[model samples]
Target chain A: MKAEDVIRFCGRSLAGYPLRTGLMLLAMAIGVAAVVLLTSLGEGARRYVAGKFTSLGTHLLIVLPGRSETVGGPPPLLGQTPRDLTVDDALALTRSSAVRRVAPLMLGSAPVSLESRSREAIIMGTTADMFEVRNLEMAQGRFLPPGEVGRAEAVCVLGQKLRNELFGNGSPLGAFVRIGQRRFRVIGVLTKKGESLGTDLGEVALIPVASASALFNRASLFRILVQAQSREAIPRAKKAILQIIQERHEGEEDVTVITQDALLATFDRIFKALTLAVGGIAAISLAVAGILIMNVMLIAVSQRTGEIGLLMAIGAPGKQIQRLFLSEAAMLSLVGAAVGLLLALAGHWVLARLFPEFPLSVPIWSPITAVGVALATGLIFGVLPARRASRLDPVVALSRR
Target chain B: MIRLESIERIFQVGDERVFALRQVDLAVRSGEYLSIMGPSGSGKSTMLNILGLLDRPDKGVYQLDGRDATHLTDRQQAEMRRHKIGFIFQFFHLIPRLTAAENVELPLTLAGVDPVARKECVAAALARLGLAERAKHRPDQLSGGQRQRVAIARATIMRPALVLADEPTGNLDRASGTEVIHTIESLNAEGMTVVMVTHDPELGRRARRQVRMLDGRIVSDSGAGHEG
Candidate 1:
């Protein structure tokens, strides 16, 4: 028979039972929609995390006094005792060709009082190069002046929020704010930079490393931040820093050096695997839908035995009979897949609107794979019923009716 | 022309093998109107089914138009049935989902005839059967006689050489049954060979040639000058 005629015949038979047809379509559609929605969520989470890591800075590496066993895991609280990294070590590291700049960091908390407005705020102490290495912007006067390493000049830069709390619409440049029994002159106010790597950048105080070390009564630095001259220099810079730090600490190799690319790559691989896992879980629904199609088609074949016998008697061969039934299944799955795509699109749109901060969008391959799988499932599940229909004895079928 | 030689059909009932047809030999000319008459279980319907290629006898050599058809493959047999034979059933067997016109057009469609020619032929067949007005109505919407007319139109739509009718008027009222019988008689008069199976003795006698069957064997043949 002509292809068009086959489709027309199947269409007539399917239309005879509206409820059954609608139910099959619904099952297939829900299966496809579930796969799409879940995969989108998985893909969105991956993108969101990737964006967060990239914002920290590129071609950057951190040198911590304690070693981190895993690349991305948090530093152990009480691991093997490691040698302290001094400001001298950080300054010496800049001598390497791969290292473009170095910013020594020391963190502590101190109470600040400016005319009875006292707040215990976090204090981040580093040199003027900290602004360039960390991508910080200045809102007011100049940052800490260029000076000798570890010079004890008491100078500070206020975070945007701290500046507002201290001076409230008034300029605080060159004003002295007492921090930990020492007076410090404010030289600059930082432009607002929201949370990054779990630190509220906009609410802290920036001071000289030497002053913070003295106030906290410590000689070793908290960590050292390094920036490579170019992206290609990151590996060399990491090697050079480790060698330099080991040499300075009596060949102890106590510090852990992690590159920004290494951290980002770890996160990328983890999220990619997570996306595939969720997509695989969602595919189980497609299999369930396939089983449903088979069950319903079996019932349809038995119910239409008389009609099938009539066709056989009129000279339609077994292959033609199989094609007719298979075409019906194909039609149902195609329609269901189209509707599922529309549902997924609408779901994505609503999710993007509701959670604007999250990067919510499906990969192009999600819909394509969904369509391919849906068609394959329909054809595969259709075989059993079509074969049974073809094998029925026309004489017996007609006689029974 | 058609020929059947020593045809034997057996049915398994419990542990007993019942012979539905035994050693039956018959030959029919190209344009003959013949009828087979018998009571229930006499195998008249079985004989009609075998002649139409709807069933195969266990031991028989059947020929149609001089072709050795007893060993034809399933597909070859289907092709032969499509081009050379048509069937009309006692129940009419019109697909209830289709309108009268679509039901009549089914055979041509299965033969892959072009839409334009198929439409014209279906229209002509329905008009000839006086079903032009009811062409768009489904089988359920038509009366018993109208449904039978539609079946006849479908059976002859392909212009097959032989038409088989098994109790074609069995389910109709007397007036509708007479109308159906007249329609088949007209087709037969147009030089179409028709083989009908019926239990009505009067209807069986209307054919020019009649064969009577009893318990799996032909007891009498009018063409051979013997009456049971």
Candidate 2:
């Protein structure tokens, strides 16, 4: 028979058993949909984390005072006391040719007042190079001046929200404000950079590192941010920073130098594994769907034995009989896979709308893989039933009522 | 021409081997109307199944139109059946899902006939069987006589050289049975060989020659002179 006629014959048979066909389609659709949606969510999470890290600037490295077992993890607890990283160590790191700029950091909280209004704010102490190293933008005025290392200059920059609270949109350049019993002039107002990596950039107060050390009465630095000259120089910059800091700390590797690429790569590997694991878990359901197809097709074959015998009696070859059953399965899987893709797309759209902050996206290969797997499953599982139908004794089948 | 020599078919019913057909010899010439009559378990249906290649005898040499058909492969046998044989069944065995026209077109379709030729041939066959007006009706919607006419059209659609009817009127009333018998007689009148199996002596007597079977062996043949 012509291919189109065979397809029409199978189509007519399926139409005769609408409820059974609908059930088979539903099972296959759910299988494909599970694979698409689960993998999309996993891929979305990976992109969200990658986006956060990329926001910190390119070819960057962070130097923390204590050592972490891995680049991206928190520092160990209750270990041997590590040598402190100081302002001198930060200054020594800039001598390396691979390093472009460095920002020595100190963190503390203090109350600030302008005239009578007062509010407590997170205080970030860093050098003037922080503006270039961390990609911070200035809305007005200038950043802190490059001066002597221990000169405790009484100048500061304010985040956009902090400036709004302290001066209420009024021009506050050069206006003196009190921070931790020390008065400082506001040199710059930072543009709104939003929240990133748990730090709300719009709400913090920035000051000269020397003044912050005196006000908080501490010489130990929290972290030192370094920028490499180029993408190729990141590893060189990290090695140089470790050597400089280790040499300054009596030849002990007391600090951890984490490159932004290393952190991003670790996160990339973890999320890729997560996506595959979830996809694998969802593929189990597809196998179950395949088994269901087998069961339903077996039942269909037995139920239509008379019809099969009739076709044989009318001179259809055994191969043609098998092809008829297989074509039925292929048709079901194709339609089901199409419906599943549409459902997954609709689900992804709803999720993206519900959570605008997440970078949700379905990878290009997912739909193609889903459709391919569904068709393969249908064909493979359809084998036994089709074989049985083809091997039936025509005389016996015809005699059966 | 048809020939069967020393045909022997056995059925193992648990420990006892029953002989369905034993050392039976028969010959049928072309363009002859013949009937085989027997009681239940007399091997009439078994003989029909073997002749139609639906079953293979344990020991036999059957020839049709001078070709050795006993050992043909499954595919070769199917090809022969597709081109040279047609069957009409007692219950009309029309696929319930298809309309009369589609059922009649089945044999031609399986032979890979083109759509234009298939349509023309199906229309001509249905008209010959007096089913052109009922071509669009499903089997359930047609009366017994009309459904049998549809089956007759399906049987002859491929223009087979030989037609086999197994109790073709067993499920119909007397009037419909007579109508179905007349339809088969008219086809036989066109010089197509007709071999019908029936237990009704009246129906058997309508044929030009008759063969009687007792148990698994043929007891008598009235038309041995017509053998090719």
Candidate 3:
């Protein structure tokens, strides 16, 4: 038979039983939709994390005290220990030409009070360079004064939430707030910002690194934030900081330096694998849909035995009969894929509206792969039924009721 | 032209070989109108099936239009059937989903005839069968006589040289059966060979050549003496 005639015949056959065709299409559509929605979710999570990392400032490096790697050698008999990372070490990192600025962090929790209203807040002590390194924006007043790194300034900046709790929409700039037996003038109030890298910047207080060292009674710094002069300078700045820290600590190389690109790349790899795994799991539904197609097509063959016999008697080749049935399957799969894509798109729109902050998006290749697999499964599963129809004895088939 | 030499067809019924046709030899010249008449289970339908290429004879040298059809490949047989043979059935096996015109167009469609030519041929065929007004009606909507006429139109749509009818009037009423038989007679009169299988003695007598079979063997043939 001609190709168009075969297609028209199969289309008419499928359209003859609307309920059966509809249910089959539904099964295939759900299979494809599940793949798209689940993969989009995994991809959305990946992008969300990547976005958070990007917001931490480009060409950045973080230095933490203590070596993160394990050494295989035995301990020295003299009891050698890794020294602490201090403000001096943080300052020494600025000597390199590739290093743009550095912020040495000191963290502590203390109660601040103004006229009997008291709230315990996390206090982060850093220098004025922290305003640029951490990408902080001031809602009012200026940031910490740029001066000596060790200068114990009696002024501090309050986070948005902390300022609201301490002052309650009143002007908090220049107001003295007592903290840990010391009074400091509020130099600035931070703008509203969300969590980044597990830290809620909206709820902490900022102070001079020297004053936090005195108040907490610890010389060890928490972390050092290093901003490279350019994107290409990140590795150079990291090497210089590690070398400088090693020299200051008697060549121990105790500090761990992490570049933003390396961290981002690690996260990117993890999420891509996660998306693929979830997508693979979702593909199982498509296999089930394929099986459903096979079952339905088998039933269709038996149901139309008389028609098949008639065609055979009218000189339709077995191969032509097979082509007719296979094209029916292909048409079903194509329409089902289209419906599934629409369902996935609608689902994505709803989810994006529900969670606007998440970078929810379907991976570009997912739809193409889902549709390809669907078509492949349909054709593969269609083979048995088409073969069965072709192999039927026309005499016996025509005799059937 | 059609020839079958010593055709033998056997059926296995619960492990016992039963002969449907035994040593059945028959020859039909072009444009002949012949009918095989027998009781049920006498292999009349089997004879018709073998003639139509729907069944393969176990032992026979069947030739059609000077070609050895008995040993042809399945594809070659299908091609031969498409170009040279047509079939009519007792049940009026018109595809119910199709209109009467599409039913008549089936043979040409299967032959890969293009739509414009197919439509023209179908219109002419249906019109020749006196079914022009009923072309748009489905099989269920048409009466018994009209349905059989549609099947006749379908059978001759490819203009085959030979037509096989398996009890074509078995399922119709008397008037419809007479009308269908007349349509087959007219086609035979136009120089197309017609072979029909029927149990009705009255219907069997209308053909120019008559064949009677008993127990898978031909018992009598009116035209055998003249051919010999």
Candidate 4:
């Protein structure tokens, strides 16, 4: 038959059962909308975390000291090796290559006095280069130079947020602050850099490494932070730095080099499975939609059995009847796809607005997925009805009212 | 030309075997206007269906123009029916969904005739049936006589040589029935073979050849010597 004839047949068949067709479309649309909404949420959360990590500068690489052993569950004590990084190890790695700067951190939490303003702060002793490695901008004055590190310079750079807390919009720079009987001058105020991986970078203070080492007095470095030329050369730069640290530690492999990209990649691997899991579950809804379509079509065929027999008796082929029903199925899915697209856009907009921190991504793939689900659902459900319609015995069918 | 020799049809109803037609033999030559007269349940409709190629006998030799139709495949029989046989029913089975013109055009369309040819042929068929003005009216819009005329037009649209009409006037009023019978007899006079089944003895006597059946067997066959 001609395409136009088939189209006409399909149109009339659908018109014959408006309510049933409408319900089929609604069911399919719901299934598609679920997939789009959930995937967008997952994408949004991933983007939020990735952005937070990147703003802290791509140069900084963290070397977590020991293996946690258990899969993200818990670190086993039996396989727990102590941290072997020392001040000397940090010094050794820092001096090798175009490794422009490095900082050995010794983090401690304490209550301090800043021009009569007292609050709890995370105190860290590190070289001025720690500011550069963390991409910290000085809002007020200068950070400690290399000549000032380990020289007992009673000077530190307070983050923009900490400065606000201590001085209440006043300049805390060029003022004396006390931490455990020691007085330090706040020479600079770090610029506003928000949280990275949930740690508020804007709330910490950095001082000379030697002074922090002596006060908190750790013979071993808590963690050595390194910065490279740019994000592109970070891997080459990290590998060289790792070799330098290995040699300095008498060929020990205790230090871990974790780059931002690698961490983001790991995050992707973790979330990829998550997205597929949700998407796969959404696929189950499609299967359910298919089943619903099939049930509706079967009922429709049974209702029209006499009409079908009449056509057959008048020389219409079994193939034609099957195609007519399948066409009806496709129309339901097509309309459902259109409705699902509109719904997905509204849902995505709401999700993005409600969770600004998580930038939900509604890629073209999301809507396309809706279409695929609809088509698949239509076919899966439509086949059984078509087959049943085609296989109907003409004699019995004609006798049915 | 059509001839049936020893035609037999047996249908199974539960554990009993019912014979619809048995040891039936007859000849219907070209241009013959003949009717098989019988009461209800005497196999008149079954014989008509078999003769129309809509059903087949379990044991028989059916020759249409000297070719054995009994051995032909279902598809082949349908093709032969499409090209050479026309059927008219008592209720005037003009498809309700189609207009008078389109209902007549169905046979030509099924034969893969081009649209231009189909249009011209359909217009001619409707005009000849005196329904040119009502060509676009569906069956429901037409009177009983007009519907039967439309059915006649559709059956003869393919110019089939033989027409098998079962109780062609059974559903019509006497005048409408007379009009329908006249339309069919005129076609037979134009050299088309017509085999009609009717219970009305007055109508049955009008055929040049009258065949009678009782108990699944032909009891008598009488005809004009020159069927043409």
The models' CA-based lDDT, in order, is 0.87, 0.89, 0.91, 0.77
In candidate 3, what are the lDDT values of residues A45-139, reduced to their tens digit?
A: 99999989888877889999988878798866896567888999999999999999999999899998888999888888899999999888899
**TM-score winner, 1 or 3:** 3
Q: Kindly report the docking quality category of candidate 2.
A: medium
In model 1, which runs have C-alpha deviations exceeding 4 angstroms?
A70-80, A108-123, A135-195, A200-220, B224-228
| lDDT score of residue A107 within candidate 3 | 89
TM-score of chain B of 2: 0.98
Q: Give the per-residue Cα lDDT of candidate 3 at B131.
A: 97
TM-score of each: 0.89, 0.90, 0.94, 0.74
Per-residue lDDT of model 2, residues A1-401, tens digit only? 88878888888888889899898888999999999999999999999999888778778899998877545656557676888888989999999999999899999999988999997998988898888888888998888788786889999899899999989968999899999799999999989877778988888889889999999999888999999999999989999999998889888788999999999999999999999899889888777888999999999998888888878888887898999999998988888898888888889899989998888888887778888999999999999999999999989888875
By lDDT, the candidates rank as: 3, 2, 1, 4
Interface RMSD of 2: 1.0
Q: Measured by C-alpha RMSD in angstroms, how accurate is candidate 2?
A: 3.7
Q: For each model in turn, which proportion of the native inter-chain contacts is also found?
A: 0.56, 0.53, 0.58, 0.00
Alpha carbon deviation, residue A94, candidate 2 (Å):
1.6
Off by over 4 Å in 3: A76-82, A112-119, A138-141, A161-191
Candidate 4's residue-wise lDDT over A93-191, tens digit each?
766564656777778776667656787778877876676777777788987777744488888778788888888867776888886568889888877
Candidate with maximal TM-score? 3
Best by lDDT: 3
Two-way lDDT contest, 2 vs 3, winner: 3
Worst 10 residues of 4 chain A by lDDT: A67-76
Worst 10 residues of 3 chain B by lDDT: B219-228
